[model samples]
Target chain A: MNPATHRHPASYRDPAGFVFEEDGILYRQIHPRYQPSYEQLKQSGLYDRLVSEKLLIPHEEISQPNTADAFRIIRPQRIRPVIPPFCWTYNMLLDAAIATLRIQTIALQHGMILKDAHPSNIQFIGASPILIDTLSFETWIKTKPWIAYRQYCESFLLPLVIGHHGVPDSPKLLRAWPGGIPLETGRTMLPLRSKLSLHWLLHLHLHARQSRQGDTPKSSSTGFSSGQMKNLIHSLKLGTTRCHAGNKHSGWTNYEQQVSARGQYTSHKLAVIQKESAALSGIDTILDLGSNTGNYSNALRNISEKIIQLESDPQTANALYEKNKTAGDQNSLSLCLNVEDLLPAGCDHGLIPSLKSDLVLCLGLLHHLTYRNYIPLPDVLNLLAQLTNKYLWIEYIDPTDPLIREHFNPERVEQRLIDLETFEKQLETLFTTRYHTQLADSSRRLYLCSKK
Target chain B: MIHLLYLDPGNGSYLAQVIIASILGVVFYFRNLLYVVRDFFYRLLGKKDRSADS
Candidate 1:
């Protein structure tokens, strides 16, 4: 492993571990202190088999001639895309949860258990999720209760359940508190029927009580027998099945009610997109940011090879993922992402993260940033301009437009309005405005800007 | 005035379940001139179910 070019984020938690990038590749450096567990991981043949099966990324043991840290560094394989939890669609979260359970089950068979269960440790490669933290596995201790189970449930399971149960903002709530929701808070929000259930009663409510148990520690340190561990893994599999069953599918389901767009207006807007996008060829990949219910995104697929329909709302995004999955759409994909907190163009700083887009379809998202979020119009346009490569497809709604007015009471945000002319001028700076026209009587203007 | 958001399966997420519930609540409580406009508002927003039954 080359340490000269390696950059380690000092803020990373693990003391015996540090991440480094060598030769445009990212790798986790396991220290001498953690070598015993690492060797056990390799000696047991768990690492080789897992990597061969693509259950885990494989890494060759590279020797680093570093005398400073007094520990040899081993470079393990790395996942290219390190997506944070907030970027995941509900289905991705659900899958990651199942993947975690699967890994835990596999680890138990290898006479090991994962010490960490943070959702951040999981990453998505294509649609499949994998456990990226190689060091999370440790020698199995038969005498301790599954301490990480509750933590894993909190980090992965609860937010998914809450989101599916109509608390659309559950991810945000969980995001706000990274340690996962306090059991007390979950107890308050969880329905009474859930509280009465055996899992909730013991794992959640009782666990909370045990945590609150002052002097006397709550649960004894008695470990599960090998058979019990197997049973526990089976129970985890059952939980994953239940979680998957509970996830409802639909695109931005709740958000559609919040926005006001007449059918005529939406159709007209979509027609303009179709007309503009149809002419472009070899430009197979299209990204429709803020794609609610994927109405327009669904149209773009006829022109492009694949459409990545992204929406921020969980309910909506979840719906989108399910729809495409059920439709057996091999070309179109949907994801949940707040436009502002978009997955960065690249994961690591120096190395290119390989998110190349041929076209960007940004429609009806202007008011969301400008009026609702109080972001300046120029700033919103600037961010959109950065995302596009060859062609920029966009729609701009008149600030005084009825649809815009309904979303934001003009009474409160009079100054927030930006006329079409002003927006056009800004686009002229970076993009050659190729397509610009009003759609129906909605006062919505569509613009197709070619990179200047 | 308070909106109850209903998140469910099969409904095109075009209408977040909460806004519909809220609009229904509004029409039930305040039967006035604006109620017609409110219905129009919901319809225009595509919140009014076109195919799927609530």
Candidate 2:
């Protein structure tokens, strides 16, 4: 078996089709069982309408089947910087919920409905969320209630409401319950005030009780009408919109202001970055470390195809993500992540190295890793080397710098760095410097290095 | 509807769903009825289809 044509771990649950990559190209193989629904999706014009509106990821049917059991094969454009549900901001989660509702509405208009409403079925390209699961649609039966209703509530609505209530760790709940936060679990966790709201009472509280009692409304007459489904969708949209994270201050939210306060230093740093980035070539993806407000990555927007901005603080990362999304900068993806605990080996169900970059940009982050995080310089260099495939743009901060001093004790700082020569010697083990320059009137030195 | 009621298990959940569906069905039926009634009068007065004209 060719390793390149292996099936994705998350794609196995859906028996209609499974996603596979062949020679770096993603393809979906539709099973023979899904032929009827697939034909209905196309014949009903839902597929064309959705593709035209960019609500669904468009695919081109392959002429030749890749495997013998395949009823049909299709090639879909790979969306980069794939993020998990837990990392999404409150607003992003709401956007996802709205997107799911929109898909359901459109599906119903075409005499179809979503078979499942899991967050994993959706992917964000910039701020816009697109449904990636083509097989989620099935011909709507008036007698059958919305089978995915409970799923929608648990996966999208519950998480958004939890986040809106000032719980920042709402997304983490997804890790524990991959199917979604259970209805009973959410009902218990939500505050008493939430129970008073009609939307919450009907969807969360009553729904949970019904589920616990093993009450399945399966009979034809007991099934809800299309009108009721529409009403439910409307209520869900309004409920999701009302759930807000409310303004809460965090440390890195005002990082751009601090940088601007050092007037000359900011401009000098920007100029140095612009000059160095302009000289680089053959770089498509960039992994930016400590991308506070995405200042450096945003500067390289024209040159890089995709920029994955990794920031430790959630507020700062979310602010940058929202800004990029609003501007429709499709190439930039901001994520809240600490470099100290980069990518866990097997956390995302065997989807290893979620984001890989041709080039890495580590600007004003060395001190944070070495001083604050207590990561040795050699270990830091090794991790950066592993993440980047080709080039690295790293910044070395002098011990004399105020930011470095603030993060580290004076004695520890002295012991760690010792001298500039020692730091350069450590970096030489993994990467060779291509371009090195000291910024004007600043103790920072920027190096454009390439893996040896 | 009677057959459906018989087939369903004697559970309150199905009954609740039936009630909710009935209410929504009534509202939807009336909402469409108003438009149908309006169209009938318009045609009776020898007027063009208001929906098509719009």
Best TM-score goes to which candidate? 2
lDDT of 1 by residue, A1-452 (tens): 55534645431566556677677766566666887788888888888767776666667766664656525565556543344565567777777788877778777778888776766667665566677777777888775546466566566666755665566546565456565666556766666666544444444555555445422232334323555555555544554455543435343465555444465776677777888778876786777888888878787777776677778777677677677767767666666666765423322212112234678888888787777877777676666666667898878877677756666867546777677678888888878988788877677788888887
* lDDT for each residue of candidate 2 in A1-452, tens digit (9 for 90 to 100): 23224876556666677777777888888888999999999999999989888899999887866566788888887787567766666666777888888888889999999888878777788778888878888889866666677777787778777776667547667767766787888877888888766666666677677667555535435656667767667666767777766564587788778777665777887887788778888889988888988888899888888888877676677788788987889888776666776633324322225666888988888887787767788878888887888899888888899787775788777667635787799889999999888877688888889998
Cα error of candidate 1 at position A154, Å: 2.4
Name the docking class for model 1: incorrect
Q: Can you write out model 2's per-residue Cα lDDT over B1-54, one digit (the tens) per residue?
A: 000000101122443344434554565578679989999999999998788776
Number of the top lDDT candidate: 2
lDDT of 2 at A306: 84
Q: For every model shown, what is its TM-score relative to the native structure? A: 0.71, 0.85
What does candidate 1 score on TM? 0.71
Local distance difference test, candidate 2 = 0.75
